[model samples]
Target: MEVVIGLLAVLVLFFAAGYFIRKNIYREVDRLEARKIEIMNRSLADEMARVKELKMTGQAEELFEKWRQEWDEIITSQLPEVEELLFDAEDHADKYRFKKSKEVLKHIERMLDAAEQNIEQIIEEIYELVTSEERNSSEIEEVREKFKKAKKTLLAHSHTFGNAHAKLETALYEVYEALKLFESETESGNYLAAREILTKQTAVLEQLCAQIEVIPALLSDCQTVIPNQLSEIKDGYEEMASQGYFLGHIQIQSETERISGSLSLFQEKISLLETEGIHESLQEIHESIETMYDLLEKEVHAHHYVLAETLKTESALQELHAEKLISKEETDAVKLSYHLSEEETSRLRHIDKQISSLQKRYTHIQDKMANEKIAYSLLKDELIELEKQMSDVKAEHAEYREMLHALRKEELTAREQLSEARTLLSEAARLVSKSNIPGLPAVYTELLSDAKRSVSQVSEKLNELPLDMVAVNVLLEDAVSASAKVREQTEDMIEQVYYVEKIIQYGNRFRSRDENLSRELSEAEKLFRHYEYESSLKKAATAIETVEPGSFEKIGSLVEEDLEELKNK
Candidate 1:
């Protein structure tokens, strides 16, 4: 019984599996049928109707027939094959042949794809033909209008185009012929051919319009403007030549002839409509003419400059000559009193030589100007250089004059300083004599003697023939320093002596009470008698300060007051 039940369950499962397999195969068959119907429904017919609306002959008619035939083949042969495959797939699924049904469905899907591609290709070809026809019809009208306008402009401005008018007319004729060909091809239904012709003619018309626009100005420059300028330049050249203005470097005649030849050649090229390099050639000719004009104008300007600057330069030369003479006289006068260095004398001689050389240059320029053959531009440059040299010479002359003045000032300063030093030494001597400090130390005496000698040396130097002020100033500085030292030392020594005396006398009061004070005061007296006042003052002040606490400072103040009073007296 268990075996039968297992066999029954097994049969149930086999039927259930077959049912599911059949259902899936039916689903696939339905999907492929739907794809085939969609492929059949593409709008290729409407696009074909568009193609038929155009002029259908020649290439257009032939393309239209080919596309229509391809569409017919897809609808009749390809789609029916897909429908047959769909039916076969449905039959296989109904009989429980799932594998065979899948194979048939796959075949139907492939057929549908091929038919869809064929329909798309036919529709695309028809659309392309229709669009080309429409574009050719519209664009040809525009191209014709452009050609008409361009030809009209060329006719209106034939004079402005100069000799290029004939060649330009020929180019317009070619464009007109191309327009005719486009119309002929369009009428014959070869729109693609018409489009090619229209494209080429449109470019030609645009180029011709541009050429017409600029040719007038360029021709006017070449024919009238440049020739008039050349004529004016030649006339100016003749006028200036007669007026004694040297204008030979310009080569005006040959250059004008060459430019005339170029203008003629340019006219020929323009007649043939070969305007590629003519614009640049005309520009070069204009620049050449401008350069000639500039050269002539420079001569005119330079002639006026030469006339005015020549007189100014001559006056400056005369002034410089007078200054040089004055410098020589002053140098001679100073030579008798002050010794001048060799470099100083040589500098004056160098100035003289420079002035002499400049004078020669001035003469040469005058001679050149008198001949009226040399270009004034060259003369102007020479005169400018001469004026600059004169300016430099004037600067040197001013500097040398200041140097001579400084020499005299320095000599006078040295003498004044010497006199002041002598007076300072005398004051120092008078201070020593009045101080009554028993005698000065040996070093102080030697310094005083040296101060006197320094003063004497400065005076002797000042008195020497061709007085070397350099040496005199040096001696004067030494005398000033020596005299100041003597005066400072004399005052310091005299104050020290007074301080020592006052301190010793003031310490005597403490001597009776402090034996050490008495002994130190005796030693201080000995130092004072020996002119060792500074040492004596320190010894005495130390003893008194030890006994009286602040006696040294009190005595120093009193001594300072007494010395101030004496100096005033």
Candidate 2:
């Protein structure tokens, strides 16, 4: 049995190894095959044939053919080796020889890598050879013609071209230098190196030409357009400053000097047309002028903003000052009514002093701004601070007013509740006087006294000057609460008396019918007469239930019937 199990285990491992190889190895082989297919589809042969038609130097074409042959040789020899190895790997996997199969797959992978590298290298060589200067000198000439066209366009607007002349002339010379280098290098059989130079020079010349072509418009914007805008910016700034707008002490002299210098410097650059990097200089100057224009616009906008806001802030401050608030009498009244703390008093004084300080500062700022002693920017923060402080003072005053209003409303409401409580207390006293029942709970009498005392306290508070309203409000609540308790107790006592009378009469119905009932009914009558209604009801009702289970319910029906008959009468 042990041997059988061991053999079965070995068989399982063998199949497992076969499964591992089949799954892993076949997938790897498929990937390698896909890579091979990609290489074949690269069309290296077709590309070589395409390059053959291009008019390249004989030596360059020979070099391309050499690499192409090398690429073909690697594919022709190594590809078959990789395919054979793949076949071997598949066979090894089929036979459950995973280790051998992995080795075969590794070999195929290496050969395929080499084959791919060879094709890529040949493709690079073919591209480089075709793009060689000897083969594409016409492209450089096309760039030269483009530069000349750009130059002619600029010269047509000669007045505007002054700023960009140096750049355009330098670029044309660079084109000449590149052409000479290309011809010299091509004659000396250095086509690739010459072509590289041509490509660089061609790109530079084209970029410079593009820069030169737009000089007419840029020159107009910089020379005519921006200077005019600068004047407007200067005028706008002065206009706002004249209108009492605080403008920060911004120096325009340096900026105006800089603009003049830049325009003059660029004009010199355009005169030195033979100078190198003139294209760069023109672009720099154009950008600088454009920057100056943008800055001028920002300054103009900033000045106007400050002007408008300063005027509004002045109006708001004047209005706030004129508004009736923050009076000593009003603040004193709040302090007296609420009995505010010492800290609150000190804070209020500090706020008043702060407002006074702010007023002085505000006047100083306005005077200085009018006299050109400060810029608009200098007073902006001060204005905001003054506005905020005034607003805070107003908020404090408003809050106090609201509190006073609410307290007054509370006083009225509390007085109304006190009146209602007095009425309830009177009604309870009258009911108790009329009922005249004995043996009541002393707690009810105490509550009645409490209600009367609470009313007295409330009335005293009301009678006082200024009313100590908070205390009065609390006393009124106490009075109302005590009155409600006394009323409930009084009403309950009266109802109990009425119930005791009803239940005693109900027990008499069985007085003659049962001797035991007679004795219990008599005992219950004594308890009822003592004002022990709850106890009396329990006693009489228990004895009565021995005769009739729902006798107490019947008694309730009789009391309701008696009350209804009395009402009808």
Candidate 3:
């Protein structure tokens, strides 16, 4: 019981020590956390001051607000956990203090990172705003005016709105900037800068002028379709006038004025169309106007009147086709008569007969040539097969000869070994007999006796050798004679094969000549049938030259002479 009381007292002291230690650790952690909060607040305030100084607005302001809210959330949610960790670490007297300090340093680093990001965002926003303000102050008014004018004009003309407005706005902005820069330069007394600005302003004005000039061209293209509905006779004069399609040099100004006059008239006619009720004719007019408008748009884009004028002229030409210059039946009759002229018909009949004859001859020659080719090919194949068979036979004979030679060499070697063995045995027996040693090994003595016996047995075996050696000699002689005979047969067979090959080669050459000659003869006959006497004679001569039998003979003789010369060498 005394020991138990003593243990309880020790536990109470331990509990008191733990309580004091935890309290001190908590106080330290709280202090560190307060310091961390102070640093974070100061960092955030610095960033906010920078943003305010930069005067961030629009999307930038929204982003900054979001960043601030995020910062608040992180501090609120994560700070408690950090404080608890610090408190827990303070109780441990290990490396926990260094570790907790490092954690706090990490939080400091994150805060710094957030501050840097905020500052960078503010700087970008400030830069953008400055640039936008500079641009707005200089060019916004002129650009707005141009955009408004373009929009109104496009709407009035029933033209495309978006693209024209965009173009106009862009051009006007450029002009506005140029003029504003000029004014600014003048106020600053910088003549060179003013001159540069003026040059750029001139270019912008020219571009705008060019764009405006296209408008009337666009209207002109729209007016061209008005002439399509008129009769060909009525439209033709106007079309030619518009296109300067007259025979001679006319004043371009006068032509232009005349075309403009016609266009005015056509416009007046089209204006009448608007007042007409919505009948089929009105629908047609609407479609035509739309088409003309599209053409005009294209013409404006291309900056050319040729395409629009060409379209108008083509429409006028289509209208002129209403008058039948020639009846369909008369045209058909004329075409038939043209095709069937009497002289042409006779010539055609003659050509047909000649062609039929030539075709028959060609087919006959082709068939004959084909047969000759087949026969030659067959002979060539036979020659190849025969050569292959001869090669196989020669290879087999060579293998057999090699085997016989090896067997003969083996037999000779065996005879030599037997003779040497006998000589060695004789020497061994003499040596044993002359030895003076009395107590010699019995094994040595028996060895001497065995050597002598072996010599005697070998001699007896040699004496009793079979007559196969004589038979071998006879067989060898017979084999040599047979090989000679085979050689002669092979030579004869080779000569026969070569002769057959030569025949096939000659036949091929002959068939080739025959085919060429037949073609020439057919050509000559065709020319003769056509009454082309000179050409017919030339073709006949060519045929004769191509197939000359003397040529083949000469070639054959030359080949034979070369073969003989090779043999002699």
**Against the hidden true structure, what lDDT does model 1 obtain?**
0.86
**Off by more than 4 A, model 2:** 1-148, 163-167, 170-201, 217-222, 234-248, 259-362, 365-371, 433-439, 513-515, 560-569
lDDT of 1 by residue, 1-569 (tens): 99999999999998899889888887887888787777777767677778788888987898888887787787888888777788888788788888898888777777777777777777776776677778877787777787788788877776788768888888989888888888888889887788778777778787788788878877787789999999999999999999998888889999999999998887777777667778888889989999999999998888899999999999999999999999999999999988999988888999999999999999999999899879999999999999999999999989998999999899888878888888888888888888888988988989999999999998888888797987887888889999999989989999989988898888888788889999999999999999998889889888888888887778878998989987986
lDDT of each: 0.86, 0.69, 0.46
Candidate 2 Cα lDDT to native: 0.69
lDDT-based ranking:
1, 2, 3
Instruction: Give the number of the best model, judged by TM-score.
Output: 1
For residue 466, give model 1's deviation from the true position in Å.
0.6
For all candidates, the clash counts are 0, 4, 0
Taking all chains together, each candidate's TM-score versus the true structure is 0.80, 0.64, 0.22
Local accuracy of candidate 2 as per-residue lDDT tens digits, 78-102: 7767778888988988887888989
Ranked by TM-score from best down, the candidates are 1, 2, 3
List where candidate 3 sits over 4 angstroms from the true fold: 1-99, 144-216, 225-349, 352-569
* Candidate 1 segments exceeding 4 Å error: 1-61, 64-145, 187-189, 548-556
